[model samples]
Target: MTEVGNRHPHGTPCWVSLLARGVEATQEFYGRLFGWEFHPGPSSLGTYVRASLNGKNVAGIGELPRDRPLPIAWTTYFAADDADKTAELVRGCGGTVGVGPLDADDAGRLAIALDPLGAVFGIWQAVHHRGIETSGEPGSPVWNELVTRETSMVATFYSLVFGFETQHVVSTDFDYLTLQLDGRPVGGIHGVGRGLPRDRGAHWMAYFEVADTDAAARQVVQLGGSVLRAPRDSAYGRVATVTDPEGAVFTVIRTEPLPA
Candidate 1:
């Protein structure tokens, strides 16, 4: 969460959205999985809905452009005070701005871009909407991470673009950097080198909090989705990677221990 009423600071992971092949079908899948309620969003971006959990906005789902035919994937958006300025920074830093720094009515200004490594992400300048209303709670986003080939190089790109300070999380052999804004951890970057998914390239991954990781993974399969990775414990929590019916990948994690 970006403190509800308060605007998120620049460089923080402010929102995550999925542009799927079918809007209603995507809504049905996510609603059943995360118990999210859908509400109409800015129509300027085509069929779009904001997903809310218990009345607080958590994410967005929009219909993919028929003409462009983009991949069915979730994109993590970072907060920007000025969307156009951010787009300039992206281009100056060797990234590509594939979409607009244009207004989506009164909601906000946005631009979709790709990092130098071709990792897709977004920049959001909020107006009426303040990004996610709740986070770190069940059914809400808990973390966002960039998985790419080299953390050092891409870390510098984000640092220059977002003024992010990178904090190394692991040894040189295992490359990981926790992105910080104002000395607080906002997101992370992981370098997997040759292990990068050839089809996906570099991309930001969104993690949603769930009450039970194993149960959630099973529920995903039950709801016509697939578990890409089985539930497993990690340093942060028990997590599993899963994809929606349309193959948009995301992770669900049990951030707290279950009752005995």
Candidate 2:
């Protein structure tokens, strides 16, 4: 198990959460699908619930405010040293701050923003709550990627804001770029393709590791969720895109097992 106790490096994807209207159903669905244990956050946090795997924090789920309804979706958060300063950088880089440079009590400071290409994400400056404690393992987050139509423009925007160095991965069929933070791969940007709805524009997608993609996808259906994309084999792994009962989308992958 990878136990992450300290804050992630700046620009790394530190956290992810689902904001949904059906909070109870969402919790039950994910809890059964991923074997996650849910714990309610401080009452000051409203309806926030932290999801853990084997006693280590993995992700979160929160009630979507009725006054400002949003489509149920998972929001990926990047680590920042100062969310207020990062919000300034986001604006300077042609993005717009949508919410906060606000504090979550003693947990952290955060801001939500829209990238130049319209992808919404968050920046978190950790305090008492460091981000995810277990990653790259079964039932933990393994990757995060932005799928956008304006690939080059979004690439430029994030690079300028987060000091990301792009490592272009040559592919005959896809335009893909890996975002590297201090020489380590943190996330990726993928060009939207013919298969996806162009009207959907750009969005960040999170992926969690699983032992079997097909089995997990089946469980998602059994638990009242929907499979957006059926499981398929890829160079990296077998993957499937799915949405919770409340419609928050994410991916699950079953990669080749690590060497013993």
Candidate 3:
């Protein structure tokens, strides 16, 4: 397990959040799936709670905004030194800021935005809350990736906006690039070409760590959620795609255990 301290470097995938339709039900679904515990969060964003694992914050869940009515999905947040400046950079880089660089009740400054290819992501200038506190272990976030049709274009967008350094992943058939900060990979972009989902479009995907991929996928179904993709072994781990009861999609992976 990895424990995160306050102040992540800019461009890191620092936090993730799910805005679902039902607050209590969403909490129960995730809590049961990942063994998470919930605690209250800033009220300015409506009913929200921080999900914790063994006393460390791992993610957040908020009730869907009544006025906005967006599709239930997980949003990956990148850390920023200055949210206002980052929002301007997003606008300057052919992206659109759909939400705020405004304060989230002193927890942080946040903004939701779309990339040139319409992939949704978030920027956070943390205050008292310093994003996720633990990761790289079962029940915590392990990766965040963007699936898009224009990998090169979106890579340039994020590189310019977030100061992320891009390295093309060498593959025969896959168009993939890893976004790096200080030579460490923070996230990735996968070029799906015309294979992008029509209804979903381009979006960020968050993957959580699990102890067992097949068991987690089964539990997702048992908890009223569904598995979009069956568990499969990959170079990184055994992984499965799943959705919550309210249709929020995420992946679960059981990577080879960390070395002692």
Measured by lDDT, the strongest candidate is 1
- Clash count for candidate 1 is 0
Error of 3 at 124 (Å): 0.5
lDDT of 1 by residue, 109-195 (tens): 999999999999999999888899898788899899999998988999999999999899758588899999888988999999999
- Give the clashing pairs for model 2: none
Tell me how candidate 1 scores on lDDT. 0.92
Q: Write the per-residue lDDT of candidate 3 for residues 1-260, one digit (tens) a residue.
A: 12225578888898999998899999988999899999999889889999999999899999887788698999999999888999999999999999998888878889999999888899998888889888888999999999999688889999999998899978889999999998988898999989998999999999999999999999999999999999999878999999999899999999876568
Residue 115, candidate 1: Cα error in Å is: 0.4
lDDT of each: 0.92, 0.87, 0.91
Can you give the lDDT of residue 251 in candidate 1? 94
lDDT of 2: 0.87
Report the C-alpha lDDT of model 2 over 118-185, residue by residue, as the tens digit: 78999988888788998877899999999987467889889888889998888787789999998998
Question: What is the clash count of model 3?
Answer: 0
What lDDT does model 3 reach? 0.91
Question: What's model 3's lDDT at 250?
Answer: 97
- Candidate 2 matches the true fold with a TM-score of 0.94
After superposition on all C-alphas, the RMSD of every candidate to the true structure, in Å, is 3.0, 3.2, 3.1
